[model samples]
Target chain A: MAVRTPTGSPSGRALGLGAAAALLLLVGCCTVGLSMELQGTVSLEGRLFPQASAYQGQEDYDASLVLEPELYWEGEGGLSCSLKPFLRLDTSDPERSHSDLREANLLYGADSWQLLFGLDKVFWGVTEFVHLVDIVNQTDLVESPDQEEKLGQPMLALSLEQEWGTLEAYLLPLFRERTFPGSRGRLRGPLVIDSGAAEYESGAGRTHPDLALRYSHTLGNLDLGLYQFFGTSREPLFLPSAGQEEELIPFYSQISQTGLDLQLVEGQWLWKLEALQRSGQGPGRGAVACGFEYTWVRPWQLDLDLGFIAEYVRDQRRLADDSPYDNDLMLGMRLGLNDAQGSELLLGMVQDLAQPSCFMVLEAGQRLGESLHLSLSGYLFVRTAEQDPLRFYQQDSYLLFKGSYYF
Target chain B: MKRSLMLLLLLALMPVSPLQALAETPEEQGHAIAVEADRRSSGFGDCTADTVMILRNREGQENRRQLRSRVLEQEDDGDKSLTLFDSPGDVRGTILLTFSHKRGDDDQWLFLPALKRVKRISAANKSGAFMGSEFAFEDLGSRELEKYGHRYLGSESLDGRECFVLEQIPLDSKNSGYSRIISWLDTTTYRLIREEYFDQKQRLLKTLFCREYQQYLGFLWKAHRLEMVNHQNGKETDLLFANYRFQVGLTDRDFRKNRLKNLRTGGGR
Candidate 1:
């Protein structure tokens, strides 16, 4: 990850920046999918975005560079995409190659879905209720700096989507450790559909074709939802050769989970409740969540959301004696800084009732320019009461700023 | 001990006072959800106010103020009008343009002051910034629900109340920004609490949070604060409501461009 410090080799850095920009443009072009216009022409506009920021706190005051040159051409065929590659030079790590291809995806639209493939970024979303539904995918698999650039492991991937009732079902094929790594996605694409509706899954994995569906509705002013996740995974419960030991959970991917959500709103007052069956990523327990919020009441864009989750994760026979990890609670808020619509700050609190641990997060961000966004988002992970020794004294802090552009 | 007993009673009554759920088939639910959304997803309800733009520089500090706005509604008669930025009363006008997945180019508009000339602002740069903000013509338009179709997803309990879930899929890609959006409507009242926006690739791009509810005109429910968080990036957007006076007294004449310059002259009132 090179921080793009324009020192003795300015031309060399420029060339690197230009090439990265070109790739970003290419990814953008591909994002538009195929052309739809019968008689179409095109026009283009782009820029070389460069930014610099300094990070403080637990670390030295080292400056980091941001170089994002983008190319954006929205064609007359009703197709358009923006590609923005980046070059970050962390002066702290001077000679390192911190440059990465970012948002290097083509945004293409088919009938029911849009596709973002390449070294891109994919975010599922946090619950509107507790803002803690951070499961399903990795929030860390960024298309930003200090992140890898494959394709589908997600450096490369293809997605299919369809809508039914208050639900949206999608299929994503990520070529990662579960599947063959490099070059696998280029040769094959994911083709999946929701299974017989007999089970809540789409039938795990592309091998047998899997599907994922999410439904969202509203009660009064609250949002409600039901979702199903299914897939076929071949990764054995334990890969001895890989030095993994322990019986792998059974029927993990086949029946990821199915759940419901409810959302309500009254004037500056909002609330949400979510009940879900454990998906493959968890202990396969059924969790019920209920939360409420208040807004516009006090100052600082005040908002509060609280949640309670009940689950039966262990000992099926004693489903009644469930633990608090089976239960979760989260609180979150947002505060505005400027009059600009997209300028604001955020704060959050989360708890695993069973584990008796929590995290409080305070993050703020601002739009400096078209592509330059400055945000210092971090959190304090705390252990309220824990038997695990490692939980005694632990904290991880991150200071990140991003400069992005669409080609 | 008496207070504790009373608190316990309140908690016992909580789940007992079940919220009334709205019963509607998928099609019926779709219609209800799309109705108001057909207007626009804008956070502003109704208000009487003035706006002035204070331009700033790279330092991000507002050093100047020039642009102005004034509103007037609820006429003596039934019809209402609005006068924007009234300086030269007779020489004023206002224009509104919607840009999105339309047939041709971006919608246009124009307002003439003298004689209250109201003209269409013809095809201009839809990509240009709006009010000095990063938002462009495409970002400011109303997301017409007519452009898409909705499917009712049933109900789930949000907070303590059940909610009707509807999935809105764009029938025409030309009409919106996201590929599909899932809307959560309160079961008792059809108010949206949360909305998930997906990109063309079916990726969850952002989540829209609506809070600070307010009751207006008895039947209508609204959110005074709205926030949209970009899931892909750390950046977020917020719309804060202030001095919202809906259905007060606004006349079409008051909206004339000629009244724009006369905003300081109380043309709005």
Candidate 2:
């Protein structure tokens, strides 16, 4: 059928030219040897809403439409290459756009000495809710509109998923894209310190590129994450629009966090916990935000996400008078749809007043057919303000609609 | 994926050159050599297609079913046999699966669920689509190998291994797709390693390759990866056997008339 792309007029032309060039280059290369693959998907979400706050509500419709490259791989002569570019849109807000370019590199994986040079997901950690898709330390959710490059967030990393354990290292040329690339955007359920970029400097007072050690080590069922974001903390990568400076605030030269992520599963119960500590970056901002969530599968998936945040968030910024002691709690339920296919639908609600007040969301996604899918969702801003609301009930809401394909 | 595999490879690959003349054509010794070569090469197992497949349409949705492969049966030329099920309630009484070696005729019968009576599946409509899939009724049969003949065409290395090559052709006209079939069977157990099937027009239309063979139950053989590539449609099917079990004491008693309906009632729920 017909597909709707997920980029504005400016990038639409650029993306088309680039994707077409990639496709042609791949097709032409087939003359020399085996063919390289091209896979993509486009996810789209459209929502009609009346209120806007950084906080997402459980029932608020965060409807989105997406389109990603259809991904495929061909094996011949021991060398394999995978090419993918993901583009998605939320007609909900152009400012809240997302996209990515990924060529999970080329590899000559034989009996041993397997190495990869492309962009791929580097799975690390075992924290259930957050770690289930913890393959890459780069960007996952591309929320913002302006993206800097194709292969959106590129990383030259190598990994050995060995029998004993796994070892990995990445050259995150741009660290900002590592932490808050702002593209994969953020969902309301929980908080993951997205991606951070390392900034560099010049002796003449110019800002060069910085580096970071975004690595992970596995010890049995436990994983340790060591991330040191070394950059002129305030050196911005992209120019801000209008009142965007506050949202993209930068203060110092470096901020690093070390944490232990654990995953343990017994029978139908799964437990995930993370303990983190941040330090040496100026003032009160260096604190810890950790939580543990346990989920059960047999009877049905009922997940409870309780977070504890003790922080005086650093050197310089404040839009409104905020508190250092913020504790948020969220509960969610996932109902299984089809056992043959293991399809499911989810419902969740949370009260994290410290971050962006109180919000509730109701979202449902189902595999429509063999190749098509559909989702219906909406969200509500239950209550906002560090102090409890006087009325305790009035709230604004937004509803969303989404559909996708895998062919 | 599963449809085309049975389509191009099953009958269309039948060898037809057995009618060729060789030496004296004495009682047609090497005359139809191509047809003889075809049968002598592929599908040489003492196999039986006791396929007990049930087509399911989505519940309450016009023609859709929740096709829960409720029952399966395996039989060899020997007394060894087996039949399995998702439930015992159905095969308890009545069910009938008919196999007509003839090309265009095949039928099935079952005492359906909700309706406790005998029913017949149309045999004449062999080419009609099954569950709107590419597979036709004629394709699901254990057409006796003797029904077709084969001849050896010597040996050659294929995909890096030396194999015994043969060609085959169906004895009857109204049977399968191949004007003739060329096959490379492994010298060991006569298992099909690679086969090239030609259409009625004598053009190579498809190829079937079997790999990663493992012996199951001393009698049953398994091909972990069976690939059927279509020359017409740019799509290829790779059937990966993640799990398979054969001859676990299943019997004809499991393939009764009453069992079909019993299993369908709650087959996939």
Candidate 3:
């Protein structure tokens, strides 16, 4: 199998270089008495696979190192700037060794309005299992299978705050292609993804202008957010290469999406829902993720808190959509020890409603002393259906350990 | 005998001091003391403070966290507060905004820095520990006079100061960690000096000592240091407050959930 560079997107590289230069200039021209702070973390991760890799040349174990640093500068008159850069080096998979600028933005805030420019990350969702409405940033797929890591997006945003609610408008200028694991990575599909040959429906390609508007408000115990976005869809469709049978080419389409996310807090229970309707690609479709989390504080007279989570996800597009949460039920439990170390454990399982496929996840973390944090996570895929996308990685169960030092 | 009776009637007609009026029922006396304390601290308007929290285990191992707090006093209901965490690297820039209500459950929201997400959380976890410290969420919130039922437990001398002792039972017993709290207030200033917490099983669970009292605005008394010790687990926590600023012009806008994302930690202000 042949591998391509995952972080070699020309548009992302150009924006990253520009931001780096701007960050240096901003720091150099700072006046006296301005506040500057630097903080970050360095981590080492190790993964152990229980079975042999399904793809040839893939290793049974892997090691990686990551460094993420954040720098912030604040001056007088409500002006501030922040820069955060992320870098990871993998020993087994070359494509996993990537770097990104998570945030490099300048912000100016006034009494009732604010302006922001540059690369930034924004999250907008209420459900735990799947983020149906969070599409502002591209998913950093090689970094985590859980889809929590995101690549910074280049944007200019303005926000107006009032007694009723907050309204925000965003103008996105650049699009980042989703990353894919290399052939040597364990958690990958059967065919390699040639991200370098990705195609866009818009003539402007990566420079297509995207627009988004959102309004968020809190009424008593309920929090609500409504948004509309018109842009190149972050989710891509794959097609077999013309000549290469073992490779797939990604196709990006223009899309318009309307989303709503809501959360209600009632006593010990938190009810959440995220729904979205989109038009583009082949046909119009809708998706929803709904869930509730109920907490038992100090149950059985113990010094810990236990939270029960249940979520349901449904996507009308089904197999056409690349998400595994098309029709699924997720149930989980979270335990917090409430100790000096801040120990916590979360166990969850996502069961496919249409097939005999399920995925189990376990995550546990605790702190050592003040600056060091240790965490362990395991992912297991059970009997996947023939048409299920998860079938490609049915034998790729693995456990990962990470230790981070903060400064 | 007629002259003595005339003098008694005149004495009864005159005004009585607050201390003499305490000769009424214990419940009435306790209610009056609480009302007096609330009145004395009512007009501060707003305040901001920097706090260092130190948590110790049984073996004396300690961990520290730093935070900044801003509070805006409300005239009709409970106060609104915002707490920004500055330390522990991982939790830096996290903020907790609270809108406390006197009659029902408070509204709380947590802002996660990494995700830039604001989540409305259930206030039923008021008994849960705060940041893995001995202090619970309820302990750090605004203390409304209507949240508890009180009874006078007489007077006592603590640290050579005459203090009024009162027993308070939480109005919402299901959410509170303690069955009862015995508080000691200074007689002169009506400032809280000490507290003893009893668990749901009616066993003594923790003791808190408030010290280093300082007066702000020429009238408002604030405690600069508080120490809480868990008797059952042999763990302790100390809160050291500094840089107390009163009437700092904090308004309701400052505590809004939308503003949480813009707050810079590590004393950026």
Candidate 3's error at A315, in angstroms?
A: 0.8
Alpha carbon lDDT of each predicted model: 0.39, 0.40, 0.86
Poorest lDDT segment (10 consecutive residues) of candidate 1 chain A:
A180-189
| Cα error of candidate 3 at position A360, Å | 0.6
Q: What is the lDDT of residue B48 in candidate 3?
A: 90
Cα deviation in Å at residue B192, candidate 1? 32
Residue A362 of model 1, lDDT score: 62
The digit string of per-residue lDDT tens for model 3 on A180-223 reads 88788888887887776788999999889999999999888889
- TM-score for each model: 0.40, 0.47, 0.95
lDDT of 1 by residue, B111-174 (tens): 4322122223323223223433322333434344444678777677877867677788866453
Can you list each candidate's DockQ? 0.03, 0.02, 0.62
Tens-digit lDDT string for candidate 2 (A23-47): 5655544555664444333456665
The alpha-carbon RMSD values of the candidates against the true structure, listed in the order shown, are 22.6, 20.4, 4.5
lDDT of 2 at A352: 59
Candidate 1, residues A264-364, lDDT tens digits: the string is 54433444555655545335455555555453311221221122222222211112111223345566676543233235677776666566666565656
Worst 10 residues of 2 chain B by lDDT: B78-87
Q: How many backbone clashes can be found in candidate 1?
A: 121
The candidate that wins on lDDT is 3
The list of candidate 1 runs beyond 4 A from truth reads A1-72, A82-137, A141-169, A177-209, A215-224, A232-255, A279-284, A297-326, A339-343, A351-356, A366-374, A382-407, B1-269
